[model samples]
Target: MSEAAVDISTSSANEIAPGIPDPYSLPLDKIDVSQGELFRQDAHWKYFERLRKEDPVHFCAESENGPYWSVTKYRDIMHVDTHHQIFSSEGSITIRDQLEDFVLPMFIAMDPPKHDEQRKVVSPIVAPDNLAKMEGLIRERAGKILDGLPHNEEFNWVDRVSIELTTQMLATLFDFPFEDRRKLTRWSDVATADLNSGLVESEEARQAELLECAEYFIGLWNERVNSEPGSDLISMLAHGESTRNMDKMEYLGNLILLIVGGNDTTRNSISGGVLALNQNPGEYKKLLENPELIPNMVSEIIRWQTPLAHMRRTALEDTELGGKQIKKGDKVIMWYVSGNRDGEVIDRPDEFIIDRPRARQHMSFGYGIHRCVGNRLAEMQLRIIWEEILKRFKKVEVVGEPRRILSSFVKGYETLPVKVHPL
Candidate 1:
């Protein structure tokens, strides 16, 4: 793997309107990073800028399972995200799915009225006021998780801190049986990781695990559907109206989606924030000096880490972009990791400054109606977690190399070994 070289896709060079010149032409699979490696680094920014300027809308024909277009420019993604009718999210959101009727969740897989309908049930539940109520619980959990970290010992922050805290908090919110919280996080990771990738296969073990999650949730949803409305998301989901009520099957599917969406992504953010801070000690010091900056620093971490790097969006109609022509049914990969560091939008795009002028404008949470439903909760978690970290620890240092996942879709650390000391 060449540190200076970034993988660039060529489909855009042929079909895209002339915008930027392609510097490196490599197969999409060639550009992927392993779990512990620092990927999509400064070099990635150069490739993205070249694409944005020359072929802002290019295609990567050799994604592991299939070919897809890479959309790197900021405005192009925004345009596609806004025009949901033209650039649809429902048909082919993931590149490796081979199912017939297997859309994962109601809202994440829908457009407009239906998307709005499904999102309405829980959007209010995660709103600022509702999220504010969760801060105390989140802080308590974050403290317990961090405090329990072994003193004078190195540990993988991903499993010990990131996954544990995020999943436990998610269980708290979902009213899930806390004993099964780890099961929820594991299933969510497997289900969302590229199916073609080896992590999740058609093996009986995988199938049984998935069925276990479904059966557990099916029972929970069945009870809630008949019971009265409560404050938790499950109660609202059970009681919410639609053209038809979401049956136990749909509720289970949506539960898997929520658990995955809310779990791994934010867990990655929490872990990634620690990594970014350790990498840039100055930034870490800034947060420690003025803990108030924790809120603003959350955006910087999202941009720097870009946990769920890019989501696949299929085009509903033939479209022309950056001089390139895209056909109907074409799959476009929105590289939010690239777009967040777009040279046109961000200054010193490669540098990790904790307080960039327009840091909030980054596409880490994504754009349009599909913007992360747990975004507020994610920010709340980060702010409170780090605020508590600052109170407890004076210094944090990465003790060893991080292990990154083999799959390309969910970009995050598999193992982040680090050591921390109390102030």
Candidate 2:
């Protein structure tokens, strides 16, 4: 749990490249990036940079989660992401494989026909037509949130705006009670948080909270089961032919996946946007002047922040990748955060440019069959928020350093102190 020392205030990439005299003197295999502290301290960038340059498919013989292969290069990660037949997502999608009896059977952790069938059930929720319908609602909420921010006073943007806005959307999607919307936020945190990260004290505590989430959702599921098919997520799952008879544990798993997936990416991106803008004032000026660039800017923000750092896949068979031999059942982690910053695939990868060409050519939404289903919905929310932000506020001043979350899986802010300036 030792945090790696790193200074992220400047825009410079780490200077430790291939064939250079090693300052740290640690061997390639000795460097492990899976420690949650690396991310909590914003220190993962240097290690990943070194890996992308020196050992794109580096292996760590030992870690908290045991041995795993690190895939840091862009094209190599894309190859693994697209070729699900070779690198499977069946057992788990985290560096730490799921516990024996606690395996969550979500589609992101599945392969093949079952994955396609299960994912199809909720696909229509974020389809183009549905997005069109959700736009006005999102705009109204964003406007209200922006209007409510305390002017010339520091506040936690992550809690007051990021979490609040996303939780409201999650409530609407689940058709859950509006009064209990914060419960959705709590459950989302519990679902993704590591035990020592302080969200929950132990695995028992985490599962207890999740089961409570399941119990609450079960009540909603019961109500929706007998009702006519509708657009809400619960109703869709209850009515979809393939999902109607989901086993209790499987149902719980899928619910958690949707809750966390729908909540994390967009919320973190919102907070990250504010932080990035304050850090790079010139880009903020460009955004303020040409609001139309917000769409492209949204993609860039997602890429730069890289909400989820990596997604793990188990090797289905022994295969050669990036000139490294991988054995069957080996854990292969695709570092999306690293790939997004890969200089080979992206121009000016380290700098945050709002108007970069091919802004969407990044790994934030992932690739292949397990690509985020709600990606468009997430982008729409960001675009709407920024549009509303431009119409009202001139700036969101980041008054202090952001407090980051402690898990490597969710790369995000826990608090970003800021004050809003009106236009």
Candidate 3:
């Protein structure tokens, strides 16, 4: 018998129709931040601020996704994130529960032993030593990308610079055919995109794109399986004892994980950094004056952007957290975006501080074992890009409001129009 498919009938309220409830009119406890519209319009900050102040571990009884406990405060989010044993990452890591028919078992959504083993297979690709070797190449590519940009004219920075640089890096990581690298970006987008987000016309189209992704990777796997192990992610999985036996579905799952893991976090930050610096002229001036601060500023940009808004974990057992009782199998969302901005934990969390003393102390890369493996690599790319930007351009001026991605999962810009004025 063929495997079951995703239930097209099941959907978030936002996907079902085309409206978000007025979060403002709802009672303080009634407001749900899971709605994609909140992030799309960039109206989530105030809601998170209210939750942090009044109800740190706020529960929304109903949402477009489902009932979920939103952990907004920094300390509380840390408690849940650190104690992964109690808050299991199994099944899914997004607010939306995985469909029974369509399950993708990536390590990030797996519990220990399995998660550790699979993650270890790919860890070396982004290990400190590997990152050190990559810096020169990253800087070279960044310089080329910056030089290639149109001068003194408006262009979508998201497409021209952000996506191009990161996609190039991703292609390199997978040892993918350089000519077809944009397919990697398309698959990454489709993997994170929602049906109502205009990325795909319907659920059917999204599944078709992902299936195509799976099919494409299967051919790569076949080629690698018979060859000597190389440095790319596919070879790592092909040779690693823990991952060598991954089924087509499992291989596809890990493929999506690496693609999005490699793509979105860095790509979004590339665009977010320019937008942040442009918004805060003083910070931009500080960066221009002292290029030495670019490394620290990279961390601040990651923290400030919080590329991924939240990561969900299901409760393994009944537990008390931040004065709220979480039942077994309950959906708990740790809002990294909110925690990064919690003033109690981060001084002036709302402000973009380029030279923040504890700049690296943020939950954007997450906490504990699941902390982003490519963090150093992401920082290196940002630092190199900014260094290249400073060398060639006086300013990457943001000329209009960024068109934010319609996603609470991937907090990012779809387009950021900017004009580069050369030094």
Of the candidates shown, which would achieve the greatest TM-score relative to the real structure?
Answer: 2
- The global Cα lDDT (0 to 1) of model 1 is 0.72
What TM-score, over all chains together, does every model reach?
0.87, 0.95, 0.94
Worst 10 residues of 3 by lDDT: 1-10
Total clashes for model 3: 0
Q: After superposition, how far is residue 192 of candidate 2 from its true place, in Å?
A: 1.0
Q: What is the C-alpha lDDT profile of model 1 across 274-378, one tens digit per residue?
A: 878777787877777788777788888888878777777777899887677889988777878778778787887767788777778888887888899888888
Off by over 4 Å in 1: 1-50, 101-105, 195-198, 201-207, 247-249
Residue 83, candidate 3: Cα error in Å is 0.9
Pairs clashing within candidate 2:
none
Span of ten consecutive residues with least summed lDDT in model 2: 14-23
Q: What tens-digit string does per-residue lDDT give for candidate 3 at 219-266? A: 888899899999999999999999999887788889998999889999
Error of 3 at 254 (Å): 0.7
